[model samples]
Target: MTYSLQTKSIQCPYCGEQIEVIVDCSVNNQEYVEDCSVCCKPIIFSVASFQGEVVSIEAHTEDE
Candidate 1:
């Protein structure tokens, strides 16, 4: 079996700057924290996927 991930562009929740991120399609659900490239703020990443496809993605601030 072969798994292929996806690259997506999203705006930072703090600075509103667009950034590119890789999404793992193998994971049905994923949550991680990453720093915003522009603002350097912690961004809580929430991803949901189904059938090796991304269904939804959300970026939130650390305090939210």
Candidate 2:
């Protein structure tokens, strides 16, 4: 089986700027931190997937 990565645009909670993130569909669950392209603030990313499909993507700040 092969897995394909996906891209999504989300708003930054700190700066309210639109940013793009890549998601790996092969993993069932993943969590990581990435800096905002616009604000340079660390953003926590949470991704949930099942059967090579994405269930949800959540973005949060350091405080939350």
Candidate 3:
């Protein structure tokens, strides 16, 4: 099986900066934490993908 990845832009809840991230579209539902590229703060990610594309995504601060 081939793993699929998609690049997405998100707003950091901590710093309000636009961050770019890679999302794995092979999974249906995913929850993870990634640091903001600009602020270097931990951010929570909730992602959902359908048919090899990301259907939904949510980015949150570490405390939120």
Candidate 4:
């Protein structure tokens, strides 16, 4: 089975630009680095989900 999870839009802490972040794990828990749509800087994203709902979200710089 598959389910679409909720998403939240958050501004980049570095550049203060808005970006859409999807926190879905319908396939599996995922971790990756995606660039800001405005500043183009990389943001490390860690997401966890359970029972089709997001359990946790962590975003930070890779250098940290």
TM-scores of the models, in the order given: 0.87, 0.87, 0.94, 0.74
TM-score of 1: 0.87
Better of 3 and 4 by lDDT: 3
Error of 1 at 52 (Å): 1.3
lDDT per residue as tens, model 4, 23-53: 6668457788888888889998878777777
Clashes of 4: 0
Expressed as tens digits, the lDDT of each residue in 12-57 for candidate 1 is 9899899988988888999999888788889999999999889999
lDDT, residue 27, candidate 3: 94
**How many backbone collisions does model 3 have?**
0
- Looking at model 4, which ten-residue stretch has the lowest summed lDDT? 21-30
Q: Taking the candidates one at a time, how many backbone clashes does each contain?
A: 0, 0, 0, 0
lDDT of every predicted structure (CA atoms)? 0.90, 0.90, 0.92, 0.78
As a whole number from 0 to 100, the lDDT of residue 45 in candidate 1 is 96
Relative to the true structure, candidate 1 has a C-alpha RMSD (angstroms) of 1.4
Which pairs of residues collide in candidate 1?
none
Residues 1-64, candidate 2, lDDT per residue (tens digit)? 7876888888998999999988888988999999999999999999998887779989999899
Candidate RMSDs in order: 1.4, 1.4, 0.7, 2.0
Clash list (residue pairs), candidate 4 = none
List residue ranges in candidate 4 displaced over 4 A: 1-3
Q: Pick the candidate with the highest lDDT.
A: 3
